[model samples]
Target chain A: MLFLRDFGPTEVGGFGISSANDLLLVEDIELVHQACSAVHVTFHDESVADYFDRQVDAGHTPAQCGRIWLHTHPGNCPLPSSTDEDTFARVFGKTDWALMFILARDGATYARIRANTGPGVQQELSVVVDYRAPFAASSESDWEKEYLANVHDAALNTKDTTVKDRDKSRSDRFDEWDESDFCDPLLQTQLRGY
Target chain B: MKVLVINNDGGGFADYMDVEPNTTVATLFGQVTKSSRAEDYLIRVNRQPCAADQILQDGDRISFTPTKIEGAAS
Candidate 1:
């Protein structure tokens, strides 16, 4: 909650990690390197792939590591935006099941699960926080490190720009730049979703 | 032949399904996922990544999981 609140008006994205014994029980939140604005977050694809491999190496399945997509909504409305819906459809459409969850700044939240097996079915889910379960003590320092490492806020200096304008600017910048500026050459090939 | 199919896509579930003899992983994937491309998923047999043409055994375990997911805000 504190991590979600720390970003204030900018959005943050993470994955809900659950155990094999209980898929619906989100035991942890895992954040990867991403470039985020107030309305969209583009995860570094290689980082996500690496995270997936790590989870598999640790004996966790991909479903346990990546099924639940969680993000924060800077506005009061927690409803899925067109971009959110489009992303959900494109990325998770083939999965047997997937979950999308959003938490708004005003404490409002929205959650839904989509099942694609047999006949496709989607149902809204209620958000619940189980306080009775044992959890690790809040590590502000660790969170700070994670947040610093993963979240590159595109809104930091572009606060005056509208979301659309920021997006356009980013696209324009990309068009003019070359892959040499990127830290990894693979990033050039993996920049598909934003 | 009955094989354990564990689809790790959305609601990851493990279930037993009867397959015809000599069914390949590619054939089973096409049957279950219908329109999904084989390249978009990681198909494994008995916990190891297998070739699409690999034939399933009577008690083999199979799983399919997507390789990419993108999360966005409104």
Candidate 2:
């Protein structure tokens, strides 16, 4: 079961997560290479490249291949766009499974879970806020209230129907592939599909 | 020299270690596989494909992502 929570303070970013069995927790959000407009958010692969390196250095494994894509909707509709689905399909789809979490300024929320285990698999589930078992954190403080008060209201009247993709070779040094030397002997055979 | 190492094997393992100044990627990888010859790992340095003989830098970031499937949770 894919699960997540509200990230009210995030402007627009992404993160690699650490999960405990069925539960998902934000190890930390990587606030890098974010191209944010009222309609959508785009994350440059560089934004997450080092974060992944750091995450692995800390002893985390890929078995927690689970991911949570956090973004906000500019309008009242909290559903994902076709491009969003495609993004999930191409990037996160490589993993066995992952989740996407969407938030709207109007308080509308949406979520989708995708898996590549056996066949075509993807679904949009209800974003039920569990006020009963509230998040273990401090309540909104006065400064937080003032900050939230000044936030723009549903800034996007229209949604972006276009697709925003990251750079081609995230593994590129300085954003360029090193094809000059013998990088790997089995490179061609292994990366045939990718 | 110091290099950052990341492996997305099971859960995953990221760490920093010292290596010879001119150590090649394959040489370092050889150390990582415990001297066993496993070739299915996707090796990248600073987000770029590196040759087996690619020399190490003082602060290069290296990562290894296994091609094996993680399947579903139990």
Candidate 3:
């Protein structure tokens, strides 16, 4: 009964998550740990990076596509930090139709589910209601398909402008870094998509 | 259901065995902290945020985490 919303990073990776039908979706423990391991250090495998890219590309239409990003705190802190906020602001500033999820080692997770409305001036992130509730079952309903189509088209239409602008800025920032410093090797591969 | 309580601060740990369903989150906190305050720790159910008054169900995964960490946003 896990329904996942998919989104792409145009230049980065794809992200999304399972939604609760009546409560919160408890992610598979092993999957959380795996995601944590992938993001813990600097670089991730190129294949993983490509997987995300393909998701984003596929979600180019605008029906009701969802994007999910996964990360973990080394210890047990689950609250987002200044850096996390900054990154989210930069990455989601343009599209503003994505969601974010954070998993902590101590089994604490947080979700920011975006609300689509208005001229995209305001965004709302809701905390999961019940962590133990089963996720909503996926449906191939016409409404669902139509919603997905809208999101896909919206993504494609703004592909050049929004995503390109963000990626360019991200690359500029990357160029300022010192390659020799102790960088997380995983990050190198993850950044390849961007 | 048995729920494991792990507090990240100073390695504080506790366990609630055979907890009944329909237990309020606030009541669970009271059970976890017998004497001190429960307001200090940030409680999460299976990783998502929840209010103290929210009800707990079967097979719930709960953890008590701290407010701060080194090299993390405070």
Scored on chain A only, each candidate's TM-score is 0.76, 0.56, 0.38
Which residue runs of candidate 1 sit more than 4 Å off their true CA positions?
A: A155-194, B1-72
lDDT of each: 0.72, 0.53, 0.41
Across residues A1-194, which tens digit of lDDT does each residue of candidate 3 receive?
Answer: 11112222111122333332311242321111011111231112222223322332443211122234444554466666675565454433323344555655556666665533455543345555564555455444643332232222123233223333444656776663567532756666565645
Q: What is every candidate's C-alpha DockQ against the true complex, given to 2 decimals?
A: 0.33, 0.08, 0.03
Candidate number achieving the greatest DockQ relative to the actual structure: 1
Off by over 4 Å in 2: A1-11, A16-18, A25-30, A63-66, A129-194, B1-61, B64-74
Question: Each model's TM-score?
Answer: 0.63, 0.51, 0.31
- Local distance difference test, candidate 1: 0.72
Model 3 chain B — which ten-residue stretch has the worst lDDT?
B65-74
Candidate 2 C-alpha lDDT tens digits along B12-62: 346678898899998888777443434555578987867888898999988
Give the C-alpha miss distance for residue A13 in model 3, angstroms: 10
Those runs of model 3 whose alpha carbons end farther than 4 Å from true positions after fitting are A1-14, A17-49, A56-66, A114-194, B1-74
Q: What docking grade applies to model 1?
A: acceptable
lDDT: the better of candidates 1 and 2: 1
**Compared with the real two-chain complex, what DockQ does model 2 have?**
0.08
lDDT ranking from best candidate downward:
1, 2, 3
Q: For residues B15-73, could you state the per-residue lDDT of candidate 3 as single tens digits?
A: 44567778887787776644254544457776566798888877676655432111122
- The C-alpha local distance difference test score for the whole of candidate 2 amounts to 0.53
